[model samples]
Target: MVTFAIGTDDFVVAGALPAISRDLAVSEGTTGQLVTVFSLAYAFSAPVMAVLTSRVPPRRLLGLGLTLFAALNFATALATSFEILLVLRIVTAVVAGTLSPAAFAIAGQRAEPGYAGRAIGVVAAGLTVSLAVGVPIGTWLSTRWGWHATFVAVGVFTVGALVTVAATLPRFEPVSEAGIGDRLRALRSPAILACAVTTTIGACAGLMPYIYVAPISEALTARPELLTVFIATIGVAGALGAAVGGHIADGWGPDRGMIATFGTALVVVLVWVGLHATVAPVPPVVIMGSLAVWGVAAWSNNAPMNARTLALAGPVGTEAMALNTSGLYVGMACGSAIGGLVLDRFGVTGTLLAAIGIGVCGVAAMVISVRRWPTGRPARGKAGKKARV
Candidate 1:
């Protein structure tokens, strides 16, 4: 739930960008800074927080992080200046970064030995759930009330998450055996680096259209509210896909499932573009159909990739997963930023073409890396089991 707050905190800002910009006397361009700053802080602080608190108790860290997150949400609600709001959002993410990794590490320690895939999927689902429930609901409420009210609501929920965690969350015993150097050593491995790149490319392709989905709907669809409908539908698809992906990761292995899924997602997005332009009044419904297919293809790979990294790093699984998780966000931030640039340089059609192109590049990177896999033989007979443990 704390992680859910973190995920929603970032996305809700996106949905309210138009409102925030107008109220704050800033450009819609500038309002996106809120999201950029938070993601930057999150990406930069996550690994460091994990390593620095390598010996700290998990429940303590989680509690501290959520408390700070709640405080930051209040700060955002009370912010009178854009500069202060920006700074606070960044600081909020720095503090909140501890939750995702710490929570996963804690969950892994508690999960049934063979149920690692299912356990981490639930943790990862917090991210999905944020998009599925938190962001959309927050956006609707923000539209009804003022944007400040949205922050206040989120702050209230953060307080609730903090309290629940304080009461029910179990204490985590930290293992401090690995030095910073050992964590650094894993990044030097070609296979690990390959996994990280796959994360980046995959997120890039996924986010290109996602960043501007609302705008696309406004431009292409007759009914504007249908934007929310498509987003809601896509959210449901992603959640279901993530669940299926977790199961496949536990069984078929990560690399094959993720790589194949990415390839399929490329097709879905391109098809969505055509459906939107040519399908006339029924575009939203068609797009929603495409989204359901895309969601499964896109999200199903998340858990498998994480599980794959756990297998890849062996004893260093926790650290690798932390970095990989951070890598995914880096991909999201960079992808959205690049997508914005593409939108600026070219129209929406051009943006669609660009997204399609990146999707292809991303797919190529995964295929080549998997086939040539820097330092391992592919699993025999198991067609989609290239993930090495």
Candidate 2:
């Protein structure tokens, strides 16, 4: 639920950008900066917070993070100026950054021997559902009551999440209690660095087309109002894909799972772009189906990615997830910026083509990372510590 609220807030802006721009007397392009600010804030904040709170109990940090998140959303709902809104968003994002990695780390800590991937996937499902369901509902609320109502709704959801988390989540100490040097060393490992690079690049590729989905939908359906449907299609597919990927990771290992997921995404985008560029104007049904496929292929890799990162980092799984989360946001910021530039210069088809190229680079990086450090292959390091998947 915490994730649901955070994810909803993270994505709802995409649907509300036009309304916000109109109300704030800013260009839609300027409104888009809200997302960029949040992403960049999160990219930088997660690691610092993870380290600062390394000794704090996971349950306590989770509670505080959600509380801050809800309060920030409420404050955002009341903001009357773009400057205030931007400041509120940046603070909210810094708080939001602390929640996800904590959730994944806790899930990994409590999960049964072989079920870590599934546990992480279950938590991640909240984010996927937000994309699928939350954004559309927020969009509807924005159109009806106003964009402010959407922020209030997210705040209300977070209240429920906070209650549930407090009542149900078990308190756990930090997994490693490793000092900064240890955490930094974990991040500096060849395999860990490679995986982080792959994750960032892959996420950037996956999100390139996603950031400009409204225009892409407008081009496909010729009815911008129907953009919600296309967005929902991606969300729905993402939810299912996360579920499937979890099981696949547990069975075949995260490496194989990510390779499959990323490879499939590459193909799906290639086909979608091909049809859009050379073939007939694709029908709404076909376009929606392609969006589903793209979402599924793109979003499925996160659980495995998290699991793999934890495995590679060994005892420093918490810190590693923090870094990985940072990478994810960095990719989001980059993808949004790249997508905006492409949209201005090349249009929707051009954005998709660029996504194809980025996806190829992402896949190549993943392949190299896996071959260099095979998933679940025990690596003997300091003091005979075995990095096991």
Give the best candidate by lDDT.
2
User: lDDT (0-100) at residue 137 of candidate 1?
Assistant: 76
* TM per prediction: 0.88, 0.92
Worst 10 residues of 1 by lDDT: 380-389
How high is the lDDT of residue 251 in model 1? 62
Q: What is the lDDT of candidate 1?
A: 0.70
- Which 10-residue window in model 2 sums to the lowest lDDT? 378-387
lDDT of 2 by residue, 1-389 (tens): 87788889988888787678789998655676787788889989987887778888878988988888999999999999999999999999899888888888877756666677877888888888988888888877887788899899889889989999899877666778678898778767888778778888887788767767777777766777777787888889989988887777777788889889888888887887777667646678888898898888777888888889877777788778888888888888777777777777778778788788887888888888988898762222355332231
Candidate 2 error regions (>4 Å): 278-281, 377-389
lDDT of each: 0.70, 0.81
In angstroms, how far off is 236's CA in candidate 1?
Answer: 2.2
Candidate 1 wrongly placed segments (more than 4 Å): 25-30, 109-114, 277-281, 372-389
lDDT of 2 at 77: 97
RMSD in order of candidates? 4.3, 4.1
